[model samples]
Target: MRRKHTLAATAVAGILTVALGTSAAQAEVAADCGPGGPGEFANHTLLVFPGSHQPIYDFVNSAKRSIDLTMYELDDTTMEADLIAAVQRGVDVRVILDGRVGPGSKYYQPGYDKLKAGGVNVVWSNPAYYFTHQKTLTVDDRESLVMTGNLDSYYYNSDRDYALFDANPLDVRAIGQTFDADFADQAVTPSAGSGDLVWSPTTSEDRILDVINGAHRTLLVEQEEMYDTDVINALIAAAQRGVQVKLAIIEECDLYPYLNQLLAAGVQISLNNTSTDTLYSHAKVFVADYGQWDERAEVGSINISNTSLNENRELGVILDAFGPRNQQVLDTLDSVITGDFNDGQTYVATTDPSCG
Candidate 1:
């Protein structure tokens, strides 16, 4: 069902309520209105995984009116129960689960059936795209949560993931518009929403390349897959131009060739193996020119692959260091990624069978 009031109206009301009661430390970060800058730096609450479950849970439990969720995978019972409880409390709840996992895959069916039986309005995602890889949740059209990880219980403690809480009205409205269209199985070209959001099958590739090319000093990246030639070339060009590029990635045999190319281009690489590392590198993050005035970080479900960039329904945001809270977010990201890169083993193609 469509919302009774317009998204803008609802957002305005919700924002006022939240602002009146929220503490200064927890206040919503507003977009920088200063002159001579792109309006990409907006309000956001950053959450890093393995320890972000409580914050996410609190966000859901605090919902009083409505909930709109789009997930690529959902097997976390805690979240499932929370959604069901939200529905029971008379809150309007709608969910879109990715349908492209194929017929025999048991990743999402149990949660799907459970949500339906629990009185939540849920449906399979639109199959027009290759996959609905977006992991986002919109609460009361006032706040949007964009995530890089699925809510799968097993990976809750083992994967390195990140999520952003966005309270920008434009972002919330854009997310709501896309949800409404996708809920009914209609086509949509998601809005950039304050020019901060990056959507796949439309502008993800270009936006990511822009981040890569625009970085003048340093680039810290963490990604699960790295097969896109354009992305690889951009990283190589950045490295060739003396940009310090450091990549943290999980070791995948199929990606050896690409890794070799990056290594040959003077890009430092750190490989994480599940057999040896405690945290799997499943995060899609790019911290460009961190700590500088032009510092910005990209975080979401968009992987560095052609399929994820040009085929899947992915969502990401480029967060700039505009406000104190936003700067804190970047600071945390820099610390975590630097540690991951330092702890990982350096990739040597000569020792790998695939590279041979």
Candidate 2:
């Protein structure tokens, strides 16, 4: 969607601190965002599909104590059944879905009914805002899966999407707390947890900008679209400071002005022709100073739009240069930046697709 407005800037907060639990061994971050697939299932795993559904099914099926899910869209019947089965097995299942939809509003009714009948607690998000667009899930209150796509089969089966599974107990507690607040339709401060699990209407812009500003050599980004003014400005500053910035995105109107500005400012910008990639360029990822000591990447449901950043509930995880998780995302983003990715003539300003 074309951006409706820009957010007032805020000071970047302190670094997020993760307190790992010693009761269970640390799980390796596993990611399958194409080219190279998911490596292993540890506390932190990133899974990409045509093969993503099985893990989600397994995650939900393995729920022994509780399952908390908040999604923008919910049309996947198989996964819906999995949630139901979890509930049948006595797992406390609760779901919060975005009530807002595009053309066909009744699309989610079937899935909702099935889950409700199967003993899951389902509710719509606070409709006062534009939409509750967060795609996050917590299991047994011990881990979370933050995603850039929906639970719908089409997304998992074909759309280029990314999912991060975090087993850090602190991360899970923060995400679970946010879910609890959203489920109750209450307001949240978005600062309860660390900075690594970036949240919208709060820290996404800062996290994104901080990564850009911290770049010493290079920056690689692949977003569905770019419209946030603060983020765009950070990219421009990075470019002006001689940071090699490369951005890959789908053709959309909301991003036209920013793309023009970035291009004029010497940032290497490219647009993805989704057809060539065999998947919609739907992943939202950022890698700053790739392969360097300060490398950082963020991948999740948050888009670079005002509505996404300020009004909607969105989630993404920041992968610092210290982890293997950063490698998988960096490799994928590098492909988009250096690949024959963008079309120069495909920008048309338009309204939000979800609104239309």
Q: lDDT for each of the candidates?
A: 0.79, 0.68
RMSD of each: 9.4, 8.4
Model 2 TM = 0.80
TM-score for each candidate, following the candidate numbering? 0.86, 0.80
Each prediction's total of clashing residue pairs, residues at least 3 apart in sequence or on different chains, is: 0, 8
Number of clashes in model 2?
8
lDDT minimum window of 10 residues, candidate 2: 8-17
Q: Identify the candidate with maximal lDDT.
A: 1
Model 2 off-target regions past 4 Å? Answer: 1-40, 50-52, 102-104, 192-194, 274-278, 323-356
